[model samples]
Target: MNMCFVTHKVRKGDGQGRVNYEVILEALRQGHYVYIIASELSDELAQHERVIWKKIAVEGWPTELLRNQIFAIRASLWLTILRNRIDLTIVNGFTAYVRSDINCIHFVHSAWLRSKYHPIVERKSLSSFYQYIYTRLNRSLERMAMKRTRTIVAVSEQVKHELKGDAHIEGNRIAVIRNGVDLEEFYPRHVDRRELHLSEQQLYAMFAGDLRSSRKNLDTVLKALVSVPEIHLLVLGNTKGSLYPQMAADLGLGERVQFLGYRTDMATWMSAADLFVFPSRYEPFALVLLEAMAVGLPVVASSNCGAVELLTNKAAIIINDPDDSDALADALLRCAADRRQLKQMGEEARRLACQHSWSAMAAQYLQLIQETALHKAVPLPES
Candidate 1:
């Protein structure tokens, strides 16, 4: 099969990029000719013998929205030219333009707009105004792409629901496939506190993601920290210009909240922590939650997290309200107070993580691609 994957990037760092990278590798492993249409490609992927890299140069754009639009236009033109040659085309949700066999949706824009901390509703800056316009534009494009796509692959059930309920996509057209974790890279481990520069006696709670966005709800984590005095937060993401440091100081959590910044050694960081805390207002799927669980860490996450669907009460504590600092704090406090229960939950979490692997996810995608190719084509809506 000649498989074509269109995405903004093909790399290991970002979530969507990593997913594209993994699936491509899997396709090649199965003896398929894989063509990657991307703006950025990792050195390793570029060097692969079986992989064909079609680079689209859209850099130096003034804004992310412009860059994305240009990339989509370029990709759509290329797809149109190769429509008859390629067996299947898989497009990333945000930038989809051309008629493709499968549209892989990582995040639903309509769902984000309805989130409690959506920038369109909460922010008042000029940048926020531009972001609102960009989101609206993307939403319009997404609807058009969905109408033309033969099949839709949603990253989570929550996203599938959003597609059907918010975007008016047919249920039969959408398939729910959850993201997978790299089990070998993120398995249960023990690390020394001194190596990570942490106190051996203090309990560490970890949160990993972009801190600048209110959607991550780090402020809620900070407030929750104020109530739970014993647990220190190990923040593993970029925080150079974020207001979280100032917010932490204002809450008198200056010493308790440690900003580690972005680190490639996330597995070690997870190993250093006692538990994982994700208080996101909205997440299509939190990959870090799976990684944390893979490293044998119990999670206290918000109900809005799509990954929470894979968890049970024995493996995690789910907070009904992401905005409620009291609920988050109480959940953390409960875990902190009970060592045996926390350990048991961590064990259960590790067990669950072991069940999900990147290879398994790729196989599922492969099977779907084959099945979609065999099914009769549905007429695309008129452009």
Candidate 2:
């Protein structure tokens, strides 16, 4: 089968990009001719013999919204022209356009618009105003594109629900395919706290992701840390110009919180920690949570996170309210109070993470693509 994939980026590091990258590799391994329409392509993917890279040069844009719009328009036009040659077309929601068979939506823009903690809702800056307008425009485009899509691949059941409820997409047309983590790259390892310059006796909780975003709900973690003095929080991800450092100081959590900034050795950091905390207000699917679980780290996360649905039993302590610092504090304290239970939960988390591998995820996507390609009928609208 000759497959065409349209995405903004075809590289690692990014969530959707990494997923696409894995799928493309799987498609190639399955002896499929894969064509990628992307703004940026990684060296490894670019050099693949079975892959065809159609790079769309996106530049000279003042804002990311404009750059993405330009790339999508260009890619859409190219897809239409090459529609005759391509057997099937799979597109990311961000770049969904004409001649798409399957639309794989990583994050529902409509869901973010409804989130009270989203930057567009919380921030009052000019940049936030631009983000507000951009989000609205993206939502409108996505809804229209989804209507025309033959099959919709949602990263989570939460996203599938939003697609049906908010975007008016039919439930039958959407398939829930949760995001996966590279188990080989993120499995548990023996890491000494002394190597990371931390006392072995001190309890450490790791929190990763863009701390600048209020949606991540890092402030709640900071507030919670104040109550759990024994548990020190190791902050990861980009910290440049973020107010989290200041917020920690203001909350009198200067000693309890340590901002490690963005580090490539996330597996090491995750393994070194006693637990992982991610109380995000809105998360379609957090790969970091899966990565943490892969490294045998018990998680204290919000029920709002889509990945939380995958965890069962005592694998994780899920909080009802992402903004409730007291609840988060209590969960952390409970985990710290019981070492044996915490260790058992970590083992359970690792077992769960191992079940959701990238290879398995790629196989599921391939099967979906094959099934969608066989059925040519247009999806019915929800009544």
Candidate 3:
């Protein structure tokens, strides 16, 4: 089958783009023709086979302005002109236009408007007036785009509910298909834990990802770190503009809480650590969570995360209240103090992560596209 993907941009730095790249590559592996339509493209990915990239003009416009842009349909038409018979159209970020013959699948990563972590609206401060105007206009456009699409693939159930309530999309119109991790790149390998410089018996905790915005709850993670002194915390990932370092300094965890920003070698970092901590206040599906689990690390995450749904018995410990520093501290202490339980949980996490392979996910996606295409007569926006 021929599949076309519409994305905000295509780059190695962007997680969404990377995931789209992997998914499309997987489709190509299955002998399917894949094309991509994006706002931007990187030179690194230009050589990929069976991939057609059309870069559209999206610079200079504010996010809100782009959200309500009148060029979506025209952009979609432009993409359609470049392709042949497209059996499926996967809209990664937002829809360009609705094609009647195309089996369109819209993947909602997060509630862009409501999310505090979004780049457009600064942390949790969308004013009532802005909300009123954007929500109405955004919903109208999104609904129009979505109504013509075949299926809406939500990364989290929370996201599905948000789309339903805010955009009036029905439950039947949406399906929860969580993003997966590449086990081959992120599995446990025997690394001398002492190579990172630490005692073999000492407890080590690590947090990976951008420690920005109110939602990541890094403040609470830092506070929890102070409460458990014996367990050292290492934060990896780009803190390009976060206050994490300052908070660590103020809390007096200066050296104990090391900030290794923007690590390209995440697998090595994950291998060196004993425990992986992510106490986010809100997350659609923290892709890093799956990566941690893939590496056989005992994960301690907040219940608010959509990826938490994927964790079954003994796979991970879910801290329901992200604001509760004591709870976060306690979970960290438990993992640190008990080696046997940690190892067991880590193994279980790896097993679960292995079960959710990209091939399996791709198969499900193909099935959904086929079903949606066959049932085109059905109403798209549920009542």
Candidate 4:
């Protein structure tokens, strides 16, 4: 099969982009001619023998009008390419590009452009006029894409519910294929916490990913740290943003919080931690949680996290309210006090992690593609 993937752009250290890269490579390994249509393509991805990287301009435009103009032109070009060479087109996030023989699978990451999530994002980022235009326009385009797609893949059931009203997609049409962990890379390893410059006695809590994104709400994590006197947070990833060293000082967390930016060995960091805390406001799939679990670390996560649904009774502690610092602190303290229980829970978490592999996720995608192709044989009635 000739498979085509459409995403924003290919860049280094991007989670979704890297996932797409892996999946594309897997499809290529299966002898599929995988082509990518992106806003920009990195040299690393372009160098792949079986992968074709096509660039189009839909990004870095100053205004929504300008962005849409580029989108229209790019969509036309993308559709032209799809008509000739592509047997099946997998539109990653931006699915409103074109019509194809297969209905594009709208793989939603988060339930964006809705009441709760949209208002929070819009208030934080866009101006009033842009918010109004963006809300209406993107919602319309998403609905159109959802209607036209061959299938919809929700990263989690939480996301499926979040997108249900917004996308108006049929339950059967939307399959839940989660983001998985590379167990080979994420499993328990012998990496010293002291090597990362931490004391052996000090209890470490970890928060990974971009500190800038409000949806992550690292502020809550910082505030929670104040309540737990003995526990220190080792923030793994970039911290040059609103919710980093500045937020730590603002909240008076001070030296208790340490921001370790972009470490090469996340598994090492996960191994170093007593607890993994993810207080994300919204997530389609908390891939980081799986990584943490793979390294035998107990997780203290927000209920809004999509991956929490995958948790076993022994492994994870889910705090429903993101604003509840006390809840987060309490969970952290519980794990800190009980070494035997914590180690047992960690073992159970690792057991769960072993069940989910990238190979399984890739296989699910292959099955979905084959099923969609088979379904395409049947004729559909016009709306």
Q: What is the TM-score of each candidate against the true structure?
A: 0.97, 0.97, 0.84, 0.88
Better of 1 and 4 by lDDT: 1
What tens-digit string does per-residue lDDT give for candidate 2 at 47-134? 9888888889887888788888888889988888888889898998858457478999988888788878767678689978888888
User: Which candidate achieves the best TM-score against the true structure?
Assistant: 1
Ranking, TM-score, top scorer first: 1, 2, 4, 3
Root-mean-square deviation (CA) per prediction: 1.3, 1.8, 3.8, 3.0
- Candidate 1: where are CA atoms >4 Å away? 376-383
Candidate 2 residues lying further than 4 Å off, grouped into runs, are: 377-383
Between which residue pairs do clashes occur in model 1? none
Report the C-alpha lDDT of model 4 over 14-48, residue by residue, as the tens digit: 65665565677578778887788777667766887
Q: Output the lDDT of residue 135, model 1.
A: 76
lDDT of each residue in 184-278, candidate 3, tens digit only: 78999887867767667767788877676666788888999898888888788778788889989999999888888888888988888888889
Candidate 4 stretches with Cα past 4 Å from truth are 10-12, 40-45, 57-60, 63-72, 100-110, 115-136, 380-383
Better of 1 and 4 by TM-score: 1
